[model samples]
Target chain A: MTHKKNTKAIKLVTMIMLTSVAQAQVTINQKLTASIYSDNKNGVEGDDGYKLIEERLEIRGNGQNIEAYARIDLTKFIDAPSSDYRDDERLERLLTSYHLGDWRIDIGDIHLEMGRGIALSLKPIESAGVDTALRGGQMAYQSKKIEFNIFGGEANPANLDTLSQKHVVDTPDRIIGIRGQIQANKALPTIGIFGIYLKPDDQKLNELLNAEKEDQNITTGITIQAREILNTFDIYIEGDYQKRRLIDQEETGKAIYSTIDLTIKETIILIEGIYLNGFEQRGSPHTATDTRVSYNRPPTLERIDQEVLETRDILGGRIRLERPIISEDYVGHINGMYRIQSPDSEEEITQIHGYAGLEIYLPDKLAFSGGYRDERYSGGALKGEKLKSMIHGEGDLTVGLEGYELHAQSTNELRRRPSDGDSGGEKRYARGSTLLGLERGGRMGLTLEYGYDTEKEGVRQHFFAGIAHWKFLEGQKLRLAAGTQRGGVKCIAGICREYPAFAGARFEWLGHF
Target chain B: MKYTLLAALLLSLSAPQSRADERPLAPEIKGKSTQDELINVADYKGKTTIILFWATWCAPCKKAIPEFIKIQEEIGEDKIQIIAINMDDAQTRSRVKSTIKRNKWKMPIILDTDGTIAKKINSTNSAPYTVVIDKQGKIAYSEEGYTSDNAEKWAERLKKLSTEP
Candidate 1:
C-alpha cells in the first residue's frame, strides 16, 4: 500500500514537471564518475575489489514568482564477497525548495542547524559525527535582525546495519523538530537564543518491536556572542538541555551541555563541558555498571541496559595558534586539546593531546614544513594506572622549477602502552612513513609512499601506496592509485574505528565538456 | 639570469587544478509539483547554482541548513538554486523522503542519497559539501565544510554568477 502511494506521488510529480517544462526557462545539467578498487587480502588483509559508477542530472527554473529546483544521483557499485562489506546501489537525494519573500519552505531529505552548532553539529570535519542528515522538511522566516526556523524529520536507517538486530530496538519511525532564533542588532553585538524539539514516531516503533511507546528526545539552547570585548577578542557562549523518554521502561534521562569560545588575533581557544544524568531508557541495556569494554559491540538484548550506561560528565578544551614568523615567508602553528570523562560511579578518564608545527619557504623555490604531536590516554577501570602514549613527527619538502615539481614527506611515530597484567611494564611501538611525488607541467603526476609499524611483541606491518594522474584532454583526466597497509586503526577525526590491514589499488576516470 | 629566475618562480606558482575547483555541483531536484516547477542550476541561464552537498550521516550539514535556507531566500529564487544534495544510499531513500517532508526545505533537493553525485562532485567521502556554478556552467566556488562564512560567500557567488552572463 505504501509503495503504491509512493508511486502515485512520483507520477504526480513527474506529470507536474512535464507540464511546467514548457512554461519555465528550463535547463539541464549532468555529471558522471567511475571508480574501481582491488585488494589482495580478504577481511583481515584487504582482499577485496569494487567498481562503482555514478551519474546525475538536475533541472531548475522560476515561473510566476515561484522558484523551484530538483536533482537526482544514479549510482551502482560492484559487491565483494566479504560479509563485512556491503555494496551500495540506488538513487539518492531528492527534494525541492520554494521561496516567497521572507518565508522559505524546504521538503524532502533536508539538513538543518541552530546557533554556533556546539550542542549540535560541532566538529572539525564535515561529518560532525554528532548529527546526521534526515528525511524531512524545514520552514523559516527572516527579518532584518531576527530569523525564525522550525524543522522536523526522520533519521535514515541505512547505517542501522551498524546495530545488531537482536537488541530490543526502538528505531525512530519518525522525528519532528522545531526551532527558533533571534539575532541581536549590529550595535548591540550578536546575541541569539535558539531551541529544538525532537519526537519519535510511535507507530513505527510498535511495528519494529513490542515497545509500548515511541521514544522522544528534546534539545533546546541559547547562545550569546560578544563583539566589543577587548577590541580584538570575540567571545561566544551557549548552554543546552536535552531529554529522552522511552517506552515500557521506568528509565528516562536528561542532559545539559555548555560551550565557550574566545578568539584573539592569530589565536583561538574553545572550552566545552557536558553532563548527562538520568535513568536507563527502555530497549537500551548498557548500564553504568559495565566497565571498560569496547563500545563498538553489536547491539543485542543482553546489551539493552547498556544504553543507560549511567550519568556521564565530560569536560574538554581546545587551543589553536597560528602566526607568521617571517612575514609571508614562514609560519608557525600549535594546536592542542584535553578531555576528562567521569561517570557517576566509574573511574575518571583523561586524555591529553597536542601538536606543534612550522612551515618555511626558501629563496630557491623550495618549501619545507614539519610538525610533532603527543597523545596520552589514562584512567578507566580494569586498566589500573595504565597509560597509552604516542608521539608523531613529520616533515615535508617541495621543490618546483619550470613545468616540473618534486615533493617529499617523512613521518615517524613512537607509541607506548602498559602491559595488560603488569603495571610497570611498557611495550615499544614504532612506525615510520614517507611519501614522494613528481609532476611535470600539466601532463601527469606520480606519487609513492611507504609506511612501517612495529611493536615490541614482534608484530610489524609495512605498507606502500602509489598513485598517478594523467590529463589526456582539455576536460578529461584519468587516475590510478594503489595502496597496502597492515595493522593500524583507520581514524576519522579523533574517533578511532579499526579497519583490517589491507592492500588495494584504485582507478578513476572523469570528463567534462 | 633574471629571466631564468622569473620563469622558475612562475613554474613554482603554477600548479594543477586547484583542489577547490574540482568540486561538483549538487544535483537539483523537484517533486511533482503544481505551481512552481522545481528547478536546479541546470534550469537557468543568468543565475548560479550553489550546490549544498550533504548526507544523512553528516552533522554539520544539518546544522548549516537554516543558514543555507536563509541565504537562498535572501538571494531570491530568480538568481540561484541552493541545491541541498543528500549523499545517502538507496536503502535510505524512504528515510530521506521522510526527512524532506518533515524539514520543509524551500529549495529544490537533489538526491545523491546513493552517493553517486557526491563522487561525481569530488567530495572526500564526507558531507556538508558545497560548490557554486556560474551562468557559464563553470564552477566558481567550492568547499567541504559548513560555516556562516560559507553561506555568505555563496550568496556573494550568486550575485557574481547572475551578473557575469
Candidate 2:
C-alpha cells in the first residue's frame, strides 16, 4: 500500500470525481490543423532539407453528462520554428468523463478496450503517430446483463523529443486492470474476465533498451473470454496466464486465442488461432485483446499479417473466406496463414501466407479488382538454409462517365532466393496509378493523376481542384498537392499505417466552425 | 523528383482563388427527419442552407445524390434549403430509408444516426461532404468530393447565394 501511498490515493479519487463532474451544462468545441512539409526525398527521417511544420489543436467540453477533452500538438523543423510563436513546440492531450448511476468515470487521458484487447488497450495507430493513451483512471459499469471495467494507468510517455526537445524522456511504469462481463440476453453466451497488474521501470527499460536493470518487475495477468456461439456459428475464445516476479526472478506464462465464425447461405467463414508460451513472450502485447489497434504497430491477426511473427515463440493459423461473387455486385476473397516460430533455440521457423481476391461489376459504369499474394519463409534465421519467397499482384479499375471519373491502379512484386542468385533471379517491383476526374454539378471538382514506380524509378503528377462554394465558410477545405509520392500502407478502420515518401509541395486547409 | 504538372496546375490555380467573404455561424445541426421529424438546423433561418454529407457506401455519395436532387429542384424550396445528410449506419437505417423513398427525394432528409450531427459538423471524415449557409447565417461554402464539374459549380454558388442579403 505504499507506492507513494498508492499514488496519493489515486490523486484523491481523481479530484473528487472530477469535482463532481463539473456542474451543469456548458459547451465548447474547437479543431484546428495546419501542416507543411518540404522537399524530402525518402522520408520518415531520411533527412534531406526535411522540413515539416505541423500544428493541431482540439478542444472539447460538455457538461451535464460530463465530457472534456484536449489535444495540442505543434512542431516545426527545417526553417527552424518560424510560424512565429508556436508556444515552444507543444504536445498535450487530456480527457475527462463522468456519468454516474450506472457508473462510467474516467479521468485524464484514457482510451481503453478490454475483451479482445486481450487485457487492456489504448488504441490509435494513425500511420505511426502511435498514441497509446493512458495517463489513467477509469471505471465503467452497465446493467441489464452486467459489465464492468476498472483501470489505473501510466503510458503515453513517448516524446520522440517532442518535435525536437520540448521534453519528455522515459516514464514507463504502471498499469492496473480489471474487466468483467456476463450476459444472459441472447439466451446466454457472453462471458469475459481479465485482471492485470504491471510495474516495471528499470529506468523505462533503460530508456528503451540501452541496458540497465535492477529489478522492479512485478507483472501479473489473467484473462478469459467466451463469446457468442451457436447463433449460426460465432465463437470467440481467449485464455492467458502470466506471472513474473523478478527481484530474485520467477516466471510463468501462457497464451492462447481462438476465433471461429461461420454464416452460410452467402458465405462468411473465419477461423483463427494463436498460441504463445514462456514469459508470455514478454507479455504486454499491448494487452487488451480481440485485436485492433495498430496505428503503427501492434496488431496480431485480425485480417492477419502477423507483423513478422509478433512476439516470437509462436503458433498461428488463419483461414478466412468471404463471399458474394457474381450477384452481389461481384465479390470473392480468401486469406490463409500459417506460422510456427521460436525466435531462437536453433532452427524452428516456418511461415506461409496466401491471399486471393476478386471483385467485378460492370453495367453502365465499370468497376473491377484483382489480387494475389503469397509468401513463404523457412528455417529459423536462415544463414545458408535457403527457402524464401514472395509474390504479389494487384489491380483495380473504375470508370464512371457523364461527368467524368476514371481510375486505374496496379501493383506487382516478386522475390525469391537461393541466395538471390538462383530460383530464376527474382526480385521485382511495380506500381501504378491513374485518375482522371471532372465534376461540375455537385459544386466543382477537377483531378488528374498519374503515378508510377518500378521501385523508385519515380514518376508522379497530380492536380486536383474542388469547390462546393459557400465561400465565406461552413467547413472550408482546400487541398493542393504537387508531385512525387510513394509510401505505402494506409488504412483507417482496419487500422494499418505507414506513409513516408514524399517529394515537394502539398497544401491542405480544412475548417469547421 | 522534380514537379511540373504545369507547375502543379499553376499552384492549384493559386489556391482556390482566395475567397473568404465573411463567414462564421454554422455548427449546429440537430437530427432525425426522414419523417422521424425533429430536424432543427437552426430552423432553416431565412433559407439558403444546403448541408449534404451523404453515404450509401459512398461512390462520391452515389454520384452526389442526383446532383443534390437537381439542386433541390432548381432552387425552389422557398428559395434554397436542400439538407440531405444521412451518414448511414443503424445497420444502414432501413437501407437509407428505402433509398430515399425510392428516389422521390423531396430534398429535406436528415438522420446522422450516431455521428451526432456529423460529429457536430466536422463531417465525420468525408463522404461527399458539402455545406453552405448564407441567408445571413454565415458559413458560405464547403465541398469535399463529387465531381462532374460540380453541378455548374453548385448552380453558380446558388446563384450567388441568391444575391447575398
Candidate 3:
C-alpha cells in the first residue's frame, strides 16, 4: 500500500514538474557512467567479472514564485552471474519550492542542517557516496531578524552502494525537525535552537536480533555564534542532547562541539574541542553492518587522512595555527590534538596527534602543498599499541609546449603501517597517484596514472590506470578510464568507510543543457 | 533503461540551443560570508560574476583560488567579480576562516554549510567547480575541475563577458 501511494505521488509530482518546465525556463542535465571490470578474481574482491551502466537525469524549472526539480537514476548489469549486485530504475529525488511573501514551502526532498551538525545534518558526503534526505515537506519563515523552519518525513538514503556495487538496504526511518534562529546584528551574537526526532520502522528493526522499537528518538541542541566579537576572535559553540533507543538497552547521548578563532591580518589561530558521549543516531534504518551512522557527524578535530577509529564516547580537541607568506600565494600551518575514547565496552584509549604543512602556488598555475603528521595511540586494553605517522603532498604542474600544454597532477601518501600484533615489526609503503597528460586546447587530453598503492589486504600492491577525455559541444565531457586501484579505509567527517579493490574499465559522459 | 536514456537525449536535443547568456538568470542565492556578513548573489546583477565552489581538502582548489583572486584584481571590481563558495562540511567547517585568512583573501567567501546553494544551482559538487554569470545575471558558462588549460580559457571568457553591454 505504501509503495502504491509513493508511485502515485511520484506521478503527480512528475506531471507538475513537466508542466512547470514547459511554462518556465528549464535547465536539463544528465550523467551517464558505464564500467567493465575484473572482479572476484581473488579473495574479498568479488565473485566474477561484469559490466555495469548507470544514468542520472535532472531537470529544474524556475518560475516567478515556484521552483520544481526532478531527478531519476537507472542502473543495469549486463551478462553477469547471480551476485550481490542488482539492476534497477527509479525516481531518485523531487523537490518543489513555493514562495509566498516572507514564507517558503518545500515539498518532496528536503535538506536540513542545524548549527555545526551536532543535532542534525542530512545532505551529501561525496567521499562516502552518501546523500540522505527527508522525503517530505518543509515550511520556513524568514525576516530581517528571525528565521524559523520545520519539516517531517521519511529519511531516504541513496540506494546505490558504490563500493559494493549493489543496492543498499531499503529501510527508512520517520523523522521530524524544527529550527529557529535569530540573525546576528550589531554587537549581539546569532543564536539558534534545533531538534530532530527519528523513529525507525518496527518491522525493519525487528529483523535485527537485539533491536527494539522506541517511543521517541530525538536529539536537541542550541548554538551560539559570535563573529569578530573581540575585534580578533570568532567563536562558535553547539551542544546536543540525544534520547534514543536502538539496541535492547535504553540509553541517551550528549555532544558539544566548539571552536574559537583569533584572526589578525594574514594569520589565524584556532582552538577547537569536541565531546561526544554515546552521540549516535539511526541512519538508513537497521543495517547489520556499518553502524557508525551518526546523523550528526561531529568534527573529528583531526586530519582527513588520520588513520584512526571513531568512537561515540570520544573526548578530544585540537589547536591549529596558520599564516600566509607575505602577499604571496603561500601558506603554512601547524596543529595538534589529544583524545580519550572507548568502544562502549573496552577501556578508554588515549591518542595524541600533531602535524604541519606548507603550500606554494606560482603565477603560471604551478602549485605544491605538503604536510607531515604523527599520531600515537596507547593506554587502551589492547594487545598492540604504537605511534602512527605519515607524510602527504599534492600539486599540479602545467607547462606550455608548442601549441599545447603538458600537465601533471599527483597526490602522494607515504606512511608507516603499524604492527598488527604485539610482536610484529612495522612496514613502510608509499601510496600516491599521479596523472600526466598533454592537451591541445584544454578540450582533449590523454593521460596515464600510476604509483598508488595499498597493503591492508595482507600484501603490498601497486595500481595503474589510464584516461582519455574530450570536451565536446557547449558543455559536455566524455571520459574513459581503465585501471586496477586497490581500496582501503577512508574517513570523512569522523566516519570511515572501507572500499573494495577494483580492476576495471569505466566510461562516463557529463552534459548540461 | 536504454529507452529512458534515449528519451532524455532526445529531450536534450530539443532544448532551445541558445547561448548560455540567453539562459535564465542564475538562481537567486543568499549566504553568509566567512567574515560574518550576509550576502545575496542577486546583488551582483549589474556586474559580471564568477561563482567558484571549493573545499579545504581539495588539492586542485588550493591551486585554483590564488589565480581566481588574481583575475578578480586584474579585471577590476567595476567590471568583473569573483565570489568563492566553500563546500566543507562540519568535520572541516572550522578550517574555513583560517584557510581564508591564511590565503589573505579580500574577496567575500560564501560558506555553503548546508549545500542549499549547491543544490539550487545544480552544482557538480566537485571542488574547483566554477560558473560564470554575465552582466545580465544569466549563467553564461560553467566548468568542472581546474587545470592550467581551463584557467586561460576562463580568464579569456571573463574578459569577453566584461566587454559586453
Index of the highest-TM-score prediction? 3
Arranged by TM-score, best first: 3, 1, 2
Residue A297, candidate 3: C-alpha displacement in angstroms: 1.6
Instruction: Give Cα-based local distance difference scores for all models.
Output: 0.47, 0.51, 0.73
Inter-residue clash pairs, candidate 3 = A40-A46
User: Would you list the rank order by lDDT, best first?
Assistant: 3, 2, 1
Better of 1 and 2 by lDDT: 2
- DockQ-wise, the better of 2 and 3 is 3
For each candidate in turn, the interface RMSD (Å) is 17.7, 19.8, 3.3
Q: Put down candidate 3 lDDT per residue, B75-158, tens digits, no spaces.
A: 888888888989898888898887776666777788888887788774577777888888887788877777655666777888
Model 2 spans > 4 angstroms off:
A1-388, A398-400, A404-513, B1-123, B126-145, B151-165
- TM-score of the second chain, each candidate in turn, equals 0.68, 0.32, 0.88
lDDT of 2 by residue, A339-442 (tens): 66663445656667777766665532344333333333445455335345555555655565676555444444454434344555544555445555444343
Model 3, span A314-382: residue lDDT tens: 888899887766545666777888877763445656666666666655544466656666555444555
DockQ list for all candidates? 0.04, 0.06, 0.43
Worst 10 residues of 1 chain A by lDDT: A298-307
DockQ of 1: 0.04
